[model samples]
Target: MSPRRILFIQTQGENAGAQEISRLVGAGLGARGYDVSHLFFYRKSPSFDAPPNTRYCSHDRPRGVLGALKFPMQLLREIRAIRPDAILTFQHYGNTVGGIAARLASSAPVIANQVSARMLMNPLVRTVDLALGMFGVFDLITVNSSDMLMDYARYPNNYSKRLRYIPHGFDLKTTDLTKQQARAAFGLPPDVPLLGSVARLNAGKRLDAAIGTLADSPDWHLVLAGQGPHEAALRQLVVEKHLETRVYFTGELPPERIGDFLAALDVFVFPSRAETFGLAAVEAASAGVPVVASDLPVLREVLASDGQPAALFVDAADRCQFTDAISRVLNDASLRADLIAAGRGLHARYSVARMVDEYEQLLRDLLAPVPQLAPQS
Candidate 1:
């Protein structure tokens, strides 16, 4: 049989979490002898890695409600032309616009990914998602965590049948760099304790809480690697809190260099108000760095344990609690070692190979011919 043609759609062509998933999944499918192509709704920056076959429609995003309504039609034309065996969309815009496009374009199965636990917090988004679900725009909804699936189960539909739980897995490969080498590359001093996070400087991430924790401990330095619209606000917060010297922003590092950044950190901090999978935390753990993160349900599901937790959990808004957790991890050598070991355990469970295998098998099953019932039955 010929290889199935799969199209992966993403809202943006950036190195954000969703885009990374799209790239990895597409690459995985391609390696499995499937034909893969990538589509991006917007291509503001050339940050995303467009493996072999990629297309950028450059759809103009108009302003406000009218623009939002018009977006799906734009996708409808493109999807109609490049009709593939199936379509997989990542994140909200892809799930909503690209999903509807896929349904209108062809009878191919449309797989929608839900990456945020709190995406429905917005009234408009919630209404849109529910409407799409009722219209059968999505054939299957893939969530990175069970906690996120539960969040969606509150609606009226029999979502249990359509929803699939697939954990976000990491590429276990590492860059050939030691902690000392990574820190030296960035001109960071050898002895200063470093606390780092790789996240977009957005309000939902609550990077201010991480900066606020810096005030509690002058001995440690905070390094943030990522860029977004909230950079100015976060910079002003750093100025207001007098954390200019202690806090450093590295803009957005390329995906390839993220491992180096993780290696340079003495401890990794994830203080997001909400998270669906906590990918960065898992990546930090994979790099053998101790993590202290917000006590969100998704974080607890991925990292915390009754036996030995992979990360130290703290209240999202409590800077004091974050500071306390960081202090304990930094002060105790034994605790650091234990956290690293726990992190390795998590890395083993969430391997990229396993994720790829599951995705491939699911796609095959979806494409398989349905069994016929016996005449007697």
Candidate 2:
């Protein structure tokens, strides 16, 4: 028999968490002799090097009523052409529109990956998601965190039955570059205590909190290493606080360079207001950097292993707590050594190979033929 075909649908073809997960999982499936293809609704970012066998539905994200109407038809055509055995959709647009298009175009099972619970805050979006679940628009919905799975389970009706928890996996390879070398690559000072975050410059990330931490730690420098809508506002906050000289904006770093970025940092700060999974924190830990992140349950789930926490938890909104935690990790040698040691084995637990194995098993189980019951006498 021929190899099973899989297609991934995501919103933007950028170097974000969802896109990165799709790329990693797709590559894994391909290595297992599966035919994998990636489809994106928006144009691929010029800086992003998308995986092999990728296609875009539009030159840019749909802007108006006409563009919105046009997207689904284009998506439907792509779905029909791919004729995949299974379709995995990522992000909001991919989960909603992509799921609908797959349902209309093919008999394949559709698995919608929900990377965040923030959308539930919007009543209209929540209602639409529930309605779609009730109507069986998707065969399954995968959530990266157990917190998210439980959140979705709270909704009434068939929504609970379709929920599945699958943590995002990472390669977590160790970088050969030393802290000094990595700092040199980013044009950062060689000796200063560096705090950094590799996340989008969005309001939800609460990057402003990171800037606040720098205010109390005059000797430290902060690196904001991603691009998003909130860049201008964050830049303004840096200026307002008179931290323009200490804060560095590296725009968006490519996937390959993420390790070097993490290597250069003394502490990884993740002040996100919300997250379905903390991918950046995991990357930081894997790079042997101590992490100080928001005290969110989902974050706790991702940053801990074997009941021991791998990061220092703090309130994302409290700059004092953030500053104190960073100070503790930096000044206390024993604590810092323990955190680094604990984080060293994280790669073994959240490895890409493990993630791919789970995905492969899930796909097989999903596609298996149901055994029929014999007639009773």
Candidate 3:
């Protein structure tokens, strides 16, 4: 039997969580004898290298509405050429446009993967998604968190039967580094009570709240490891709060270096106002760093191990609550130990291998079976 050709379409090729998820799933399937390919809906080439057997199509258009409008046709052309067995798309623009393109081209079974709940905020997009679903443009709609799935279910025109929740997997790296060694590698002071978070410096991430917490607590330092459009504003805010010397912004660490960064942290903080699935928090748990995250349903679902919460939760809106949670984790040795132990239990359920296995099964099931012919009549 010939290997299944699975094509993945994503809005942007940037080094964001959705892009990373697509890469991991696509690469894993390719390794297991699936002919997997990835297509960027927009023109700008991604900084990361393409996975094996993956191809990126360039349709260079200036960013924003113009580019989004032109994307479906470009994507349709690619789908017709590839003639894939299955198509999976990630993010808002990709899902809506990719689904339409696949339908137009008669490409394959379309799987629209929603990584964030951002779509709910946009009425137009939600309307388009519903239209696509009703028209059978999307064969399946996958979300990473149960909370996000519930949010979509509440929509008036939702295609509830087509929705599926598939959690993101963590590909943890092994790092044999002591706290002191890890701090030195990242140029962080070994003595300070370091609070760390790995996130894009975006408004939704609510990193400014973390900076404010650091400002009030002179004894603690913060290290945010990631880059985004909000960096300049965040830096200015940090300066305004007089946290310049204490706050360290590690522009963007590569995948290998993330384990070392996690090793150096005293506590991991995820203060995002909106998070579909806190992948970074899960990675921190894998590293045994006690976490303090926003009290979101997605966090509760992902951070729970054996019916116990692996990480501390607090409302992102309440800065004091976030700080208090971090302080509790830092000041109580027993609490830290308990959280770390519980975090270790998450490794089995959220492994990259497990995620790939589930995705592989779904893709294979979606593949169109060969047509049957009547026996000699």
Candidate 4:
């Protein structure tokens, strides 16, 4: 049997959580004897190498009327040349483009993977809305959580069909580094209780609440990683709140240090206002660290819905609740231990291998004699 050609598309150069998920899934597929190709929104030329039968297509367009007009034409042309058997796209912008381009190129199936619930909540522009409507015409729609799928289905009158929830991929079998080893590697004190939060430095992340919660507890050291537009505001808050000692700003650590950082932390706090699937929290869980996250729809879907609310839950924007949750998780060793155990069990289901296998099954199922669509009427 010949390997099927799959095209994965993303319309950005920045490395966000969604892009990382796509890369992991794509890499997994490529390794498993599938012809997986990734298309970039801004690649000027094939500058780097990809896996066998995998390559990037340049889909750059300058920002203007000319660029806007030329984008669709260029996308159509690229799709025709690639001639992929199936198409997969990440992020809302890429999904819109891929949906339209795939239809124009051929009747082959397309997969629009929604990794961002933030984008799904807002009222999409008419153009993007039309593009999403095109998504209904595709073979399948994938979301990281049921909340995200519901977001897509919110406007049923305007929208077309149901979407499937395919959680973000992770390697649960990753090497588990000991707290002592991780601390030594990062050169941290062995005894101090460390609290960590990893996410984009944006207003919606609500890390200020975490700082406020930890301000009085000098012994409860906190580390805020990831850079974004809200850095100045967060830094100002740290000084204003007199939490300069309790809270440390490490900026954004590279991808390599993710496991190390998670390992060093005694507990993980995610105070984001919105998270389709908290990959950081999941990683912390896989590392056997207790997590404290916001009590939101998606957070519950990711953590609580599975009957494992042992991980402390608090309002994302509530400093009081955030502080209470963190304190409860940190001060009470028994509670933390239970939470970590439950988290590990829950994390087992989210491994990257399982994620890739699900996608492979979905693709194969979609290519079956009568392709099943989203399991909806």
Candidate 5:
């Protein structure tokens, strides 16, 4: 028998959370004898090398109006060529455009993966998504957070029936580098207390509040490990507060260096204003680095194990609360040990193997042959 072919469709092949999930899951399925492939709408990020079996609808940065008009035909062509047994999609463009293309080009079951609640906040986008759900454009819709699953279930009509909850998973590999070695890689001071965040430098991330925490803690240095549109503004904030020397910007670290970045940090700070799944925080915990994060419900869901919270939760907007949480984790020896222990526990809670198992079962159920009924007498 031939191996089942599964294709993942996403907006771009970037080093983001959704892309990472697809990479891990795709690799897992391939190991299990499935022929896994990826179809990205835009060109791959320069910092992120495209994995094998990857295809792109556009070979450059997202084209403007002309690209949007041409995307359907391009996507349809790719779908026809792949001829996957089932299709899984990520991001808004993939969920809508990819779903439509797969429906038209193949008879595969289409699964739309929603990793963010931001789309639901937009009335027009939400309306369109619900309409597509009503029309059965997607066979299933998966969410990474239970809270998001509930939110989608509340939509008027029966759109809720298609929703499934599957939390994001991680490999949780142990870092070989020690604190001093990791710091040396980034040219950071070996002795200074360090706070780090591995996230896009965006306004919604509320990274400015992280800068504010730095101002209050004179002894601590901050490292912003990712890049985005807000980088220039954040650099200015570091200068305005005279923290140019204390704040380090490493741009975007490739996947291999993420563990090293986490190893060098005393406390991992995630002050995002919103997140559907607090992937970075969970990752920090997996590295056994204590975490200080926003007190969001979704964070509460993903950052807990056996009813114990793995992070120091705070109002990320409040400089005092944010700084205080970091201070407590640093100053109290027992608390730091406890948080680290709790964090290590997350390795099992969000194991990549477990996530892959659930996904495989879902595909099997979707592809199972329906029983034929007896002929009428």
Candidate 6:
């Protein structure tokens, strides 16, 4: 009856969505009495809290060769040291490393999660597709959404037979603060209707669409939270569309303060052209904010759900439609109320506790036949 050890791997120790999920998985599993260990590529110390049992491998990626020279050695040493019951990886590169390490270390179940669409990760996608073509290293490939799985129709073997659906869930806890209070705390005005979007400023995310949607309406304030490679391009688009006064780019905020941000926004807009599950949009809906987003099938599967539709989806590329969707949420108060209620209802389905329960069950089932897990270190 000792606690099972799970090694969670990541590359850059940044506070991106993937990193956040890794941190949450480690911390959450630890909270559930599992011995969790963390491994990073560059080995820089993380800003967020790591689990009690977390250990850093401190490996670095190599210049030319696909494998990290240091990680193999360090990971081998760590695996021998911890002898984890399983290894969980957050992204492609992490999966490659963790999966390979698990195979090298021995028959520890290696679980890999795919967070985004393969083709949409810029030009490097083909490289990933080719890498995924060799999935002999992976054990269980857990995806955040079925919509994400459906997208790999062209490359059916990207998942092979080890695919499993284990959606990433957010901590579902929010404050019962008034709109004015929430806005003031999150640094927003109570008067102007705020349309908030939280996503990396990447090409595939299509954040510029949010700015484009506001070309005609000068009254609505658009706040895009998070930073990425496309920051300069998005800023240039803001200038090009003459949205300097209406839109503000708040660089990536910490994960803890999201509730404050969600509370401040009257409407939550996700204009991303591509997403596997759109976890941020789910967070917004969980906050009970009216949600408007693209008609991307994956996003629709996650946010604009079938049982209870929470999102007003417009054509991803059509700014007119996107604008109309935003305007509809802003103009109609009754509609806003209905959307908020429906969003809350829909958001109820996605929570960290539920996700943890499901994932823990999966782990238990998979590890049922394995030897006894070690005690928490």
Candidate number achieving the greatest TM-score relative to the actual structure: 2
User: Which residue pairs in candidate 4 have backbone atoms (N, alpha carbon, C) closer than 3 angstroms, thus clashing?
Assistant: 170-352
Model 2 compared with the native: what TM-score?
A: 0.94
Quote model 3's TM-score.
0.91
lDDT of 6 by residue, 1-377 (tens): 67888888765555567877777667777888998877766543334444355556663334455454655787778777888788777766676656677678867877777776776754564465345535656666778887765655445565556677777777653767777897777667679978888887788878877888787787888888887789999899888888888788767777776777788887888877778888788878877888998888877677754466778888858878888889999899888887777778654577677777777877887787646668888
CA lDDT of 10 in candidate 3? 78
Task: Using lDDT as the measure, name the better of candidate 1 and candidate 4.
Answer: 1
lDDT of candidate model 3 versus the reference: 0.82
Which residue runs does candidate 4 get wrong by more than 4 Å? Answer: 13-15, 43-78, 105-107, 118-122, 125-127, 134-137, 157-162, 173-177, 187-190, 242-246, 304-306, 368-377
So what's the TM-score on candidate 6? 0.85
Q: What does each candidate score in C-alpha RMSD?
A: 4.3, 4.0, 2.9, 6.0, 3.4, 4.2
lDDT of each: 0.80, 0.86, 0.82, 0.72, 0.86, 0.74
N/CA/C clash count, model 4: 1
Model 5 agreement with the true structure over 41-154: per-residue lDDT tens digits: 976567865667999988875568988778778889999999999999997777877888888999999988987676434576666677778889888888988888877778
Candidate 4, residues 179-286, lDDT tens digits: the string is 789777766677888988788788777888777776667688788777767889989998898877667776666556777778888888888878778877776776
Candidate 4 CA-lDDT value: 0.72
TM-score of each: 0.91, 0.94, 0.91, 0.81, 0.93, 0.85
- What lDDT does candidate 3 reach at residue 133? 73
Model 1 CA RMSD to the hidden true structure, in angstroms:
4.3
Prediction 1 global C-alpha lDDT = 0.80
Write down the lDDT that model 6 would get.
0.74
| Collision pairs in model 2 | none
lDDT of 6 at 322: 85
- As a whole number from 0 to 100, the lDDT of residue 23 in candidate 6 is 72
